[model samples]
Target: MRESLRLLRDELSRINSPDELSSWKERFEELLREAVEKKLGVKCRSPVYLFKTLYHAGFINREELDALLQFDELNDPSFFERLLERLETRL
Candidate 1:
């Protein structure tokens, strides 16, 4: 999960404000679900819990975490990875 955490760290750094960070939570949630499923080889029953795990693991802060879970968005893994890469450097 080192790669995943690294990716999350990169993504978090890209967040310019709490607002944008919140928006990303939804997308990040989806990404987290997919990753969890792939890594565990099973479907996750609780997306909320999964999101919380990711949040606590360093994907985002409390304010943005709430927003991201509340927001709705599509998942673009490539874009997400790129965002993470950009944010990592910025951070």
Candidate 2:
């Protein structure tokens, strides 16, 4: 596992293009989501609670959360709750 991580780190260091980096970022996010699902026994696709938990844990960054929720509010609890309700309805 350490060897694999070392290799991955070396490869990441050599990546130069935005397109390539973006591809890698997507893959890493998918891997993290899969691990989270496996550990929590929840399908992360439609679970706002799980996503919020991850965000609070710093496992998911603000930019990633914004993309998922289409929300930009940082400290507005009421607004965030409303958005979560709206998004849940869309599911």
**Best-fitting candidate, scored by lDDT:** 1
lDDT of 2 at 15: 68
lDDT of all the models against the reference?
Answer: 0.56, 0.49
Clashes counted in candidate 1 amount to 1
How do the residues 32-83 of candidate 1 rate in per-residue lDDT, one tens digit apiece?
Answer: 6776566545455676676565566565567545744644452334545554
For model 2, give the 10-residue run with minimal summed lDDT. Answer: 71-80
Q: Report how far residue 81 has shifted in candidate 2, in Å.
A: 31
Model 2 agreement with the true structure over 1-91: per-residue lDDT tens digits = 2233334345456667766655644543454456567555556774456567567655556765665464322333333334334333322
Measured over all alpha carbons after superposition, the RMSD of each candidate to the real structure, in angstroms, is 8.6, 11.9
